[model samples]
Target chain A: MKTIQAVSYPVHFQDKAYKELSSLITKNGYSTIFILVDENTFEHCYPKFIPNLDSEKRIEVIEIESGEINKNIETCIGVWNAITELGGDRKSLLITLGGGVITDLGGFVASCFKRGIDFVNIPTTLLSMVDASVGGKTGVDLGVLKNQIGLFSNPEMVIVDVDFLTTVTEREIKSGMAEIIKYGVTYDIKLFKEIKKNKGLHINDLIFRSIEIKNEVVLQDPKEKNLRKILNFGHTIGHAIESFYLESEDKKNLTHGEAIAIGMVCESYISNKLLNFPETKLNEIKEVVLSIYDRINLLKEDFAGIMELLKHDKKNVNGQVNFVLLNDYENHKLDCKVTEDLIVDSMEFYNF
Target chain B: MKTIQAVSYPVHFQDKAYKELSSLITKNGYSTIFILVDENTFEHCYPKFIPNLDSEKRIEVIEIESGEINKNIETCIGVWNAITELGGDRKSLLITLGGGVITDLGGFVASCFKRGIDFVNIPTTLLSMVDASVGGKTGVDLGVLKNQIGLFSNPEMVIVDVDFLTTVTEREIKSGMAEIIKYGVTYDIKLFKEIKKNKGLHINDLIFRSIEIKNEVVLQDPKEKNLRKILNFGHTIGHAIESFYLESEDKKNLTHGEAIAIGMVCESYISNKLLNFPETKLNEIKEVVLSIYDRINLLKEDFAGIMELLKHDKKNVNGQVNFVLLNDYENHKLDCKVTEDLIVDSMEFYNF
Candidate 1:
């Protein structure tokens, strides 16, 4: 029920968020209100979201297909054309009610529509609530390159309604848990210990804490110049792996969290080898991550492809692929470079 | 050539621009430097542009086709892909070298690439040097709607070299004169009087004064909320006519300045009827505009389409077509509404 203040906007929780959203709509007097949703949100959340907003304004729903594959410029063009066709204009407000793909893509659509329009994020999935909610990073992937095209543009507000979580699948919940686990490894030892307890995770408490931790880091470095790189601890390898799986003939798609869970395990091994990361902590991290996420079998032929994908990582400076490694729980080393052979060795370690 | 200090960056003129650019390249340590140009700039300006930049950084030229018709999302996707394929990254520098279309499109491309990269505008054509060089308005048009999608994002600096003017056609120079003329009508009577003198016009003084007037207006109203609306004095009707000619089956493709010349004539009539603008001054404006530009005959059938296009103007607040009109030289009124019949009469007046 608490509202967390971001750099420019506020993140509200529970039923109170709807009240805030209603007031915001009245205050702004937007010409049109557009809610951007994927198939999932349109089915479940849309039914709930409409009744809550107390406004007589013309509300229109713009829907895209549900998946990471659809998060590209083609879909953006569709939404833009749709908004224009639907009589949406400069004073229109876009409300994104779905997962990361919806929020990220929707936020970007608003940012470019008529130079920029007001938008609010009502994140339905846990991945979006804690991860996408705080960061103003709005963009879609260029090909399989994760978030290759996007800019940091803040939303009017972020509303996190827990009721939407009940509609999500168990796998979807675990996908979000990856980012929370990331917060544990890179920022908070207590969060890591809580997950390590092996009991049912306190979803609400975890989501609130993860948002707080992520917001703190973003406040200091919104553009991801230095300190923010720590949030990318597992992402360098995770994104490459995600892209590799998506493009492979097998088409073994991985949820973002699932890929990142693997990335954390592999990066932990590299951290132990290069940094003075204790052997025990490395083993503990791998065990904890593996326990939460099913181990993915990476094809021996896949290593070269994943490495190739790493070259296109957004974090890379000049020609070198940079990684965020941890020396211990909550102790991060930024911009560390490793050889392709070492990365291969880490994957081999994961297979073992 | 004294550099004009804009809101954030300096506007360097002539030979001194190259010196400032070389020093900037040395200072930023950009990973790569990419220059965006249309075919015209690539052929005429690129040869001269490359020799001036004194850096060993990897320089690449990405060329789009010439003209306003190509200023759409398709061209942007191509440039975005080209930048990605050419190994452009976050630290890359994009130097847009051409007229308004090239700078506007290139600036938008850089602003969205990896969230944003540093870009410099090197306006080669007279139109760009005075108009596009100062305003950070970057975007591509959607369909026939002019500037339907874009954001206000600044470039690192703008290099205005008058030497490139020699490469431009008389018509192209005249297209730029429209914006300078708009500035004259909305902001400074001296500029209007100077253009009225008809002594073949002074290029350097006009360019400098145009930039100063535009920069001063932009500093106060960067987002075009109030005072900045004056800049759109003729754009509301000018853009509709421009789009009308482009989409017409005959494809008359009136040069931007020519279409705007008609717009100023029509809108000035509206100003005279509604705002009590002196009819004699309006006739003087018409004469001055007609002297430099040839009139495009608009079919009676075309008037309805141009009117329909007015509804899509970006300046519309709540379905009301907003126009910026002048009561007198340097005395402007914002958000003026005119009836359809009066608009028709105004066009008839132009025909007369």
Candidate 2:
């Protein structure tokens, strides 16, 4: 297990991670240590994480409810009040020990607590490890909108221990694979091939490679001014879909990965039409993505709601909905705009 | 009027300030310019501010109600939702025009909106001009606790136009004088002499000198790690007093400057007792502070609530309540802890 060097911090893998975390704890000499977790992580991950002996500082655990719906300012208020009541101060250290929801919310809590305190990310779920935790993007969804409130605040270190992944279900792993597939399509065809060939077999190798690709993209443009827009490849339409399902009373909420998986297929169809994306490659991407993810039947009526939400996407600048389109594997075009009709056609293609 | 160079941005005065702002707006070519204001600023400051012909970018006004009590996460969610609803994107520039409340709340709002947007602080009130808008510290209160939730985020530029002070109340002007008085006590005795000699007549000189002293300290320590804590000399107890009065229903909330005036008096007494501070100097300091401000009668019953609130002060690092104490004018100590009995005695002295 090698340490992946980030912009300012290090990302340590399995065995070395605990040692690094312990050393950081002793070195920083924080007034107190507060670990942020959800119910799921508290039940499964915290037990395993606590045994790795660290320091003498008093450690307090703050837990929020599990789920994406809880990832909002209301939840943040609860956690902020909890930290204040728990005697957490400017010198305190917050360790996020769950999936993306915990890390995203916890990272934001630490960043804004007393005008920024130190924090570490110990991403337990596959989605968090590969996508959410590594990048300095810590935020919560606004209403039904995804990641509408947040900032780019890096953690002390990211400890990626595969041991936590044992508790994650197969569905969660596949959800994470959507991002891995994104990396393959946008940055590296090798990654796309690896996931397509082995499915989710080499979990460790896939996670490491996906993180490296994300790190490279983030390092070039941490603030997402230009180069970083490509990472929003599936996110534009995916987030709208995610928000739509979550907001709809009748529809079952789709996981972040599930929504993105459908988005990748729809976007690929759009790319095939506009960018001369090879039809053969589009079918290959669609088949492989659908093989791993259940083909969601997006109703015609749902299109209006999702389209309305798309107008509020964070990536939009100057009233234009921007999408990251690809010509082929590993070749992404930034700031590409498609018409509503083309978008509808792509959604229809996904349903078919 | 000279432009005071900050760590990254410039603090432009009256005439030059508007020019700098107009140029910034033109150069950045922001997608939309959102002006955040309170009801007071919307009524008084916005009309004067808008005539200073700026860019053709779409300008949107986001009005929050005036008062420190409204500075909380709830207000932030409303502003964030409004920004989303009003077509505010990443390329949006937020111009906070009002007192400390607007700048502090608006700065935090802009920083967290779309993971940070460009923001300019136009401090309309005396309190904001000298202290809040200049410093990179932006935040909202949590349950009567002042600045309990926030982060250190600098604005693009700060426009200190004293012409807007015509709209400010005498009491509000006196409130801002607290921080100016704090500058004299902590950083420069010359500032103390000027204020005492002129008695608020020389407003322009006072604001500039206060900003200079504050900028110097902030430059040395932007994050309030070491030397910057000196700025908190009167703040530790001052904020507790402010929070105490704000929370008490029967009592009228003391303005920020008024609470700090009481705090300076109380803290000076503590310095005289613990730090072997000169007795005559402490009396002189007390007289100068009391001359411009009305002394509030604090009851013995109020001591417990004030003391309890002191424990939750943002300046505290460890479990101990930290105070920034001064030996004499321009000579201060950081991270100094005093007995709870002594704190109670200081309150008694303020009453006396």
Candidate 3:
């Protein structure tokens, strides 16, 4: 088993991850154990997942409807009531098993349940294992706003098992890859070059390296005050575009990574124009992102909606949109203000 | 002006509080300022409060219906949306100006808003000033459960002004006194005797002493793992009684302190029976509680209802109800399990 001690908790990888989970459960001496899972993971992963653990304590299961839309206060109420109905107390242990939605919402619920109880994460998706699971950020969306309500609470531990990725769709795999690409673009040029060179990389190695890159950055700035803003390389505009598509009636729904893939391209164009980023490097980034994610075209009206959404971004300050742009590979500049006209031009550049 | 530095934040007393708040707001440089007020506070306290502080930042107000019943997810949603619509961001400042209901819910909404924003609490009621404002506990109830969902996040500062107590009703004042009496019983026998002797006590001094006792206990145990359980002396049965009345159609709603007064009497009797607590001391405690609070008759059916609610107490473990019993003056025994029949007897003792 490969173990990475994160800023606040340990992330365990490989076949022996469940063994560590069982030991943690026994050593902690929790009164009861409750598992929170979404509908999809409950069906595909629960049986294979729970049998690996060894514990005599009573284990309860709570399942919420699968998807991002279900990650709301209503679902939190249902899960909270389930724990209450099952007699969960302050000393009870909550093990969240599933992807980002499950881990994020479940983590928030656990953090707020009876002024918080002990919780561990067993992230079943690649996106969650590398990005959501490693970072201590836990929250849910409000209306069309993504991750609008939450807290900075770390789980007691995070268990990452690549075996669960076998059930994930290819689109989901590509979506998770976008975040991995982000870590490379922002911090490690060598890793970015390696990813671009090898299309069929080992999933475990990819997950570990991506998480390592994020962990190093997070350890330096846990609160996203300054240095941590670098982690938002594509997130600022990406999240706005994601929210616009999520709420739009006519547009096709974009996965988190798909929107971010487009966001990276637009942001790269802005970097090249304003930050003196090399045109060749920007082309390389666009080629890799376009090869994995389908190109998304933004119409003139869509540009207005996306730009309006950008004003509400959490990263924005005093109603100004801020972006993290790379001047050279692994040399990132944070909190750079970009004008609406320049953003529109970048969108047109992506369209071309 | 008197100041008590808590484990996490400072509680400022009298006129200097607003000055401190102004300094904090200026130093932090928040994007915007939002004040969360209950209907009562908005009508009675907001006019006086705004004149004291000096800041050029934009200040917005969000008002919710006053009282404990309104402290639920529905109110949180309303306040959260109001902040969102008014352009609240990570750098926004939330100033909670009301009683326990406002501070508890507002603190929670702020803690979860954009994964938390800076908040300052200006407690306007006596109960809130002494008990609610001192503790970092922030949350709202789920159905009949009191504080079922919450977090242990501290506000940046707490402002306690005794002038606001003038608007508080006598019944409300007595409700706040119950927690003060609990602090005396659990830690300071000297303060207990002082309260017993003086009918017309200094309100500010009393508030300060009660808060000091609580802060001392909390500093020792921030997360109620062990020593902090002593603070739950009257809360176990008190919360159950409070919840019972909250849900009952026929029973008149009991204020928190009123319920706790009855709870203290019942638990004192149990202490006398099981732990050899001084019978005369128990009688004196009962006399003081009954003199300030009107004695209410509980039927056999009400006892069953209260007992059922006790099973759902957050302090309980593995279906066993735990109590904090007084073995002697200022000596507490925590996590002591009592039989169901003994609990009924304690209720009978209170009835007599």
Candidate 4:
């Protein structure tokens, strides 16, 4: 029973609230346990993780292959099979241990296992702990789409320990940082400034602030009915760039965070052009980000291709490109609708 | 832009509402569109699916290998790559086109595309339309672990057209029917009785009733915070039984519904033993289910295994073995917190 108190969750970041988990279990006195993990974490994390679990003889560990390709029906067959094989009764508890992949997948698994199950998320990566862990949103990806498949099932408990980030690579750290930065830009200007220095980004501070900002947004709108959509500041272009990279042979060359960093910058330019974000601030944003991220050059041909890609973005409400455009740093978000012309114009900023 | 209305939603069904899809799109003015399908649906149903589709110049179709095994991070990566290669952007609209597997996977994909995306579900099978499509629960399973990896995100709209079920096999129908039957038994007694007296179940009538009953329960508790647990009556023991079949080569294989039928009977006996369900009603319950589902003999050696398996049931509230017991039909659901002795005693009823 590990309990982690996120910074924004503020009071304390304890995993599973040790006393709470034990007391709850004691009160309930349930029979079984289910552990959900992906291929990478099961092999790597479970060796040490299994011994510490209190599931006793009733434990079953279900593992899926790691990556976004397996996040569909076929993988569900594996889950359906595992649940069947494990003889998971309704009384069983599923504990998810992995990165965003595990937390998202585990929550979905628990939600649909007998129409829903009790699940706890033990995120083991910077991205998952900060971004995926707090939000109740869970799901897998579909082809040419991201998170097209999912639900809003909150976990019984979220165990976000920085210890998990220790195993992550520099690239993974950056991917998680993209969202952390988004939080600062969308809502917390001060935090954004702090992270911009890249000074307090020593894993612990980033984790706390990122988690804190997310918790605040999530608390306001558990379901992204409104304000939460503001969090998509950099994600709009980030996702498309990610898709662009993923589709090409250059897939290996790009990371999730790197793409999002590029997205934030592009969208920032769009924000400046469409939503009247001041040029001074826009340049400041560009300067701050360009200093950290290698600027990506786009071919003229790729401009149309990229614009075409942006059309597939899910944020388009009803068909209009609904962007979480920035206004006065952290003061406002304009859900602006951009056309291809404007979109193409925005890409020029990234070329520099 | 196709819509289906099997459950008497406030809106009109397929063709009539397709205009609305276009209207919705036209009104909002979308940028891009992406469709999600599994291997089976892609090959079999896609040709028929595309003509009626709300076409976009920048649209792309993504396909994942069909089957539950493929639903996971790896598959999500495949989707991410497809979306990337296809150049999907934040303005993208994802349409899920398949059975439960496709919708579940696709929904998750859209949700995490760039943290989250807006998508719609076109559930092709009865099981999915009735179960998966409505709930917005999306995810893939871990190897030997059912639905171990996932996220929760609802579609912008749910389109359930029974026309798709035409391609379903009898076995598939039964699998879907298992859930229909559960809804009847647990939530609506009238529906249960309606399903019971069937010289053979009428396709439309039975399916309609099942969906209606399910809709009622779902509407009451959109999220399974409470009240929805009754739906797990048969699933509690049933899931473990299903897993037993999957794990043991010698055990007779059963479809999801068939296993639930067995679980209902055994638990009916348990309900009688623990909660004073009348012997006559218990007998009626068993008779109805046994007649519907063929019997499987349980060896004494399997008792310990089954008992051990109960702990794996993810529905256990805390650590307690929670049972959804019925006092009489669907009128009353008694949440029974049973001890090890009661669970073991109940297993005896399933011994042939």
Put down candidate 2 lDDT per residue, A214-253, tens digits, no spaces: 9999999988877787888888889899889988899888
Q: Please give the CA lDDT of all the candidate structures.
A: 0.89, 0.88, 0.89, 0.70
Q: DockQ rank, highest first?
A: 3, 2, 1, 4
Any runs in candidate 2 off by more than 4 Å, and if so which? none
> For each candidate, what TM-score against the reference?
0.98, 0.97, 0.99, 0.63
Which residue runs does candidate 1 get wrong by more than 4 Å?
none
lDDT of 4 at A98: 88
- Candidate 3 residue-wise lDDT at A246: 84
Q: How many steric clashes does model 2 contain?
A: 1
Candidate 4, lDDT over the whole model: 0.70
What is the lDDT, from 0 to 100, of the residue B45 in candidate 3?
93
For model 1 the local lDDT of residue B312 reads 90
Best by DockQ: 3
Q: Encode model 1's per-residue lDDT on A202-266: one tens digit a residue.
A: 68899999999999999999999899999998888888998888898767689989999889888
Interface root-mean-square deviation of model 4 in angstroms is: 6.7
lDDT (10s digit) by residue, model 1, range B17-84: 89999999999899999999888889999998888989999999899999888998889889999999
Model 3 spans with C-alpha error above 4 angstroms: none
